[model samples]
Target: MHLLFIADPLHSFKIYKDTTFAMMREAYRRGHTLSVCEPQHITWQRGSRVSAQVLGITLTGDPTQWYEAQPLRRAELKDFDAVLMRKDPPFDSEYFYATHLLEQAERDGARVFNKPRALRDHPEKLAIMEFPEFIGPTLVTRDAQDIRRFHAEHQDIILKPLDGMGGMGIFRVGPDGLNLGSITETLNRHGAQSVMVQKFLPEIVDGDKRVLIIGGKPVPFCLARIPQGSEVRGNLAAGGKGVARPLSDRDWEIGNALGPVLQERGLLLAGVDVIGDCVTEINVTSPTCFQEIFDQTGCDVAKLFIDALELAISAGD
Candidate 1:
């Protein structure tokens, strides 16, 4: 199989922990040809198919110099057996527009994983709203009064921006409501933008668990990103320690419930963030933790993903 990965620059990848690197390495090991391009490389002319200037790569065993690559050349998206969209997010305007371009590629017969339309439809933070049963008491609003009322009712709450990734712009307000007004204004951009506020789950101390869903099934093991001292966010990027563990009963419950449903929507992979028993976010854009879980549990998450991708492509044929 020939695989094309639309991801961030190869040089920037932390190969040890990067999930896309794991996928590429696994696929390469299995005799699949690999190519890579960033989202910016994707282009579509009025009369031409969506194409990208991609580099054909061969994975080197050495971590320091991970991959050997061919010079960049233009290729139609439809030519690849699979195109994995692994771009990290702010999910800003450019990312949004890139999805449309990928969607056009899909129409041109490109088999894109986590389908372009599905990515647009499911905003990581907002996606959890669809499954209120799995989440905590949450509120999304731009109105300051609405946030204040929610704070009054929930006492201890977490306020976060709608598009924040890696735990950015997240704040916790206690019963005293310290900085509640300022946080509300800051997060909501003084009524210009909307924010999400949820009842604080003290279980965050246990870790903010990332339940990776691949091919509509749980990965069996999850990476529990536990917060360090004085930090409320348990994101790995936020200095949290990642500990891989077998999924708890509640974690299984959430993953099992959300897995197939999200898969049906063309999300070949997703990361369901769970704090205790509640679902906090449904990350579909580029759900990760593959290497962390594999390193500790020997689960071979990348193999599972590539297996699923192969099965999907073969089924389509």
Candidate 2:
């Protein structure tokens, strides 16, 4: 099978921990041809199928110069056996527009994973709201008074922008309400933008566990991104240490409950974030931690993902 990865630059990947690289390597080990393109390389004309200027690449098994690539050439998205969307986020306007193009490619018969419309519909931060039973006390709003009210109720709260990734712009307000107003204004831009406010789960010290669901099934292990020092965010990008461990019962519950539902919505892969027993975020956009989990638990998450991908493709056929 030929797989086309719509992702960030291949050169930018940290092969040791990059999930997309792990997936590509696993797929290549199984004898699949690989091609790649950035979202900006995709284009569509009024009367033509959506296509990308892609580079055919062969992995070198060397991280420094990982892959040898051919010159970019135009190819219709539908021509590939599978098109994997692995672009990282800020999910800004460009990413939004890219999804529309991918959706159009779907209409042209392209097999796109984590389906385009599904990605657009599930904003990572906002996605957790759907499963309130599994999450902490949460509120989504742009109004300062609403945030203040939530903060007053929770005493200890977390505030973050709706579109943030990698723990950017996240703030913790304690009982003293220190800088709660400032954080709210900063996160919501003085009511111009919306933010997510939740009761701070003290269990964050244990780690922010990433429960990966592939093909509507939970991976046996999850990577726990534990906060270091005085940091509150447990994201790996925020300098947290990653430790892979077997899924806890609550992790399994959340994963099992959301997996089939999200899969039905065309999400081939999802990373459900749990801090203690509460679901914090539902990460569908380029979810990572494949390498960390595999390194510690020997659970082969990327292989599971690719297996699911193959099954999905076959079923579609």
Candidate 3:
């Protein structure tokens, strides 16, 4: 089978922790051809079939030189056996445009995993709103007054931009509310942009768990991102400690509850974020932490994903 992964540039991959790189390695080991292209490489002019300038690639043992690419070739989306959308987020206008192109490919009979429309429909931070029972006090608004009201209602709260990833733009305002007005303006652009405010989960001290759901089931273990020093964010990009452990019962329950619904919606993989028993985010676009859990637990998450991918392909046939 030939697999085409639409993702970040292959040269930019940090193999030790990049989930896309891990998937490539696992796929190559299983004798499947691999091709890669950045989102910008996709082009669909007047009469074209939504093709891409894709480069066939092979993996190397050396981490620094992980991929060797062949000359670029243009292929219609239907040419590949599977297409994995593994682009990281800032899900801005460009990212949004990429999904529309991929969705056109899907219509042309390309099997794109974690389906494009699903990605657009479920923005990470606001996705948890689908399950109010699983979330804490949350507000999504651009109004400074609304944020102030929410903060007043919940003394400790977290404010963040809905499009932000990797702990960026996250601020915790406590009882003192020293910089509430300023933060509201900065995050919201003074009533122009929307921002999210949720009650701060004190259980963050324990860890912010990333529970990966693939092919409609839980991974059995999770990578807990524990905040460092005075930081309130438990994102690995923010220098949080990644500790892998077995999934807690509550975690399993949440995963099981959401898995089937997500699968039905064409989301093949999801990384559900949890602090204590409440889900804080449902990461559909480029959900990560596969390597961290593997390095600690010896559970080959990449292999699991590949196996599921193969099954999905065969079932599609």
Candidate 4:
């Protein structure tokens, strides 16, 4: 199968730590032709048309030093069996534009993972509000008075940007927290973009679990990320330590409820974050944690991901 990954630059990837690299390596081992490009490399040529500069990729035993093929363009992306929208996110205008382009590609018969429409319709953090039973005490609003009232009610809450990913722009406010006025002003100054405020789960000190689900089934392994001292964030990118762990009954219940709907919507892969039984986020845009789980558990999750991708592509064919 010819596979294209729209993601960050190849040179910037830390082969061992990056999930994209792991998947690329598996694709190479399976003898599938792999091409990669960044989101900016995508362009609309004409109506319902798109193009990109495709870089060939190869993987060696020492995962860090992978090989690459000369960059080229196959004007018709449909020539490739599948395309993976693997770019990391701030989920800004540029990301939305790329999704629009991918939507065009889908119309032309190329299978795009996590379907462009689903990604656009589902903002990771906000989507979970639909399932309040699986979530913590949360409120999404831009009005400072409303936010103040929520703080007063919860006493301690976490405030974070609505469009944030990888644990960025997150803050925890206590009963005696300062700068409520200033923080809300900074977050909503430009416009009325609402921020999320939820009751802080103190059990997060033990670590937050990242559970990977593919093809409507939960992967056996999970990574429990322990935050650094005095830090509320447990993202590996934010200096958290990832340790392998098994999912609890609550985790299984959450996955069982969310998985079928996600697969039905064409989201073949997802990474759900759980802290003390409350679902924090459902990551669909290039979810990570594969490498951390593999390193600690010696499980090659990349193989499972590839198998699911292949199954989806073949079904489409």
Candidate 5:
């Protein structure tokens, strides 16, 4: 299979931690041709046809380092069996534009995992709000007064940008926590972008779980990311420790409810974060953790992803 990955630059990937690189390496090992491109490289020519400068990728033991095939424009992306939208995010306008292009490719018979329309509809933080029963007390708003009221009610709250990923701009405020006015100002100053304020789950002290789901099924390994001292964010990017473990019953229930919906929407792969059994985020765009899970449990999560992708392609055909 010839696969095109629309993602960040190949060289910038941290070999040890990047799931994209791990999957690319596995795809190569399976003798699937892998092509790489950043979001900006994708464009639609004519009315609805899409094309990108697809570079063949070769991954070695060191994930950071990779060799590339001569860069070339794939005049018709439909030629590739699948295109993995693996770009990391702040979920900005450019990312949306890339999805629009990918949606065009889908219309032209190219299978795009995590279907373009679904990706557009499902922003990580906002999507999980659909299942309030499974989540913690959460509020999304930009109004300072509302935020203050929420803070007053909850006392301790977690604030995060609506569109940010990798734990960027996540903050925790305790009862005596200061800077509510300043934090509200900062978040509101950035246009109408809302911030998520949730009751801080102290159970997070035990670390948060990142559960991977492929083809509507939970993978065997879940990584408990323990944040460093005085940090509220448990993201691996935030210097947290990744420890592998099996899913608890609650984890299975979360997956059972979320899996079919995600697969139905064409999200073949996702990373759902749970803090004390409360679903926090449904990570669709470029969900990581495969390497961490593999390193800790010797599970080849990359294979699960590839198997799902193959099934998606075959079913589409």
Candidate 6:
């Protein structure tokens, strides 16, 4: 299969722990040619097909230089066997527009993994609301009064901006509610921005586990991103220590329940963030942790992903 990865720049990848690099390497190992492009490379002229400035790359085993690639060439998006939207987010307006172009590509018969419309539909933070049983008591609002009410009821609550990633702009308001008004102002922007408020789970001290779902089935192992020192955010990017572990019963239950359903909904890959027994987030836009799990547990996540991708492509054919 010839795979085109709509991702960040090839030179910017930290290949050591990057899951997109992991997928590219696995696809190369399986004798599939791979091309890469940033989301901004996409273009759709008035009557021409959706196209992109893409570069076909060969994997180099060298650690410092991971890929050997040619110059960017314009290519029709529908020409590839699969288009993998693997860009990490701020998921801002630019990302939103890229999805529209990909949606058009899909209409031109491009088989994109995790589907464009699905990505647009399931905004990571908002998607959790659908599976209320697996999450803690949560509220979404920009109104200061509503947030205060939720914090008053929950006592200890977590506050976060809806557009944040890597745990940016997250706050914890306890019984004393220190900086509550200020934090609300910063996050909600005087009711112009919406933020998510959830009852703070005591179980976060254990670890925030990332359960990978490929082809709607949960991987047996997960990366438990343990918070270091006083930091409350357990994201690896936020200085959390990633430790791979077997899935707990609750982890298994949540992953299994969400996996097939999300797949049926056209999200082929997902990283469900599990804090204790409850799921905190469903990562659809480039879900990660493939390398951490494989390095720690030898679970072969990349292979599983490629196998699933192959199956999906074959099914489409």
Error of 1 at 65 (Å): 1.1
| Candidate lDDT (C-alpha), each | 0.93, 0.93, 0.92, 0.85, 0.85, 0.92
Which digits, one per residue and each the tens of the lDDT, describe model 6 over residues 2-99?
A: 99999987778889899999998889998999998988889999889999999988888999877788887999999999999999998899999988
| TM-score attained by model 2 | 0.99
Candidate 2 local lDDT, 39-149, one digit each (tens): 999999999999999999999987689999998899999999999999999999999999999999999999999899999999999998788899989999989999889
- TM-score pick, better of 3 and 5: 3
Better of 2 and 5 by lDDT: 2
Between prediction 1 and prediction 4, the one with superior lDDT is 1
- Model 5 per-residue lDDT tens digits across residues 113-201: 77899899999999987998899999998888888899899999988888787788888878975998788777767447678899999
TM-score of every model versus the real structure = 0.99, 0.99, 0.98, 0.96, 0.95, 0.98
Which regions of candidate 5 fall more than 4 Å away from where they truly are?
60-65
Off by over 4 Å in 4: 62-64
lDDT of 1 by residue, 1-317 (tens): 99999999888999999999999988989999999999999999999999999999998899899889899899999999999999999899999999999999989999999899999999999999889899999999999999899988999999999899998999999999998998888888889999999999999999999999999999999999999999999999999999999999999999899999988989999999999999999999888999999889999999999898998899872
| Total residue pair clashes for candidate 6 | 0
For model 1, name the residue pairs that clash: none
User: How many pairs collide in each candidate, listed in order?
Assistant: 0, 0, 0, 1, 2, 0
Question: Which residue window of length 10 is worst by lDDT in model 5?
Answer: 59-68
For all predictions, the C-alpha RMSD in Å is 0.9, 0.8, 1.0, 1.6, 1.8, 0.9
Report lDDT (Cα) of residue 55, candidate 4.
79
Off by over 4 Å in 1: none
Q: Candidate 3 deviates by what RMSD?
A: 1.0
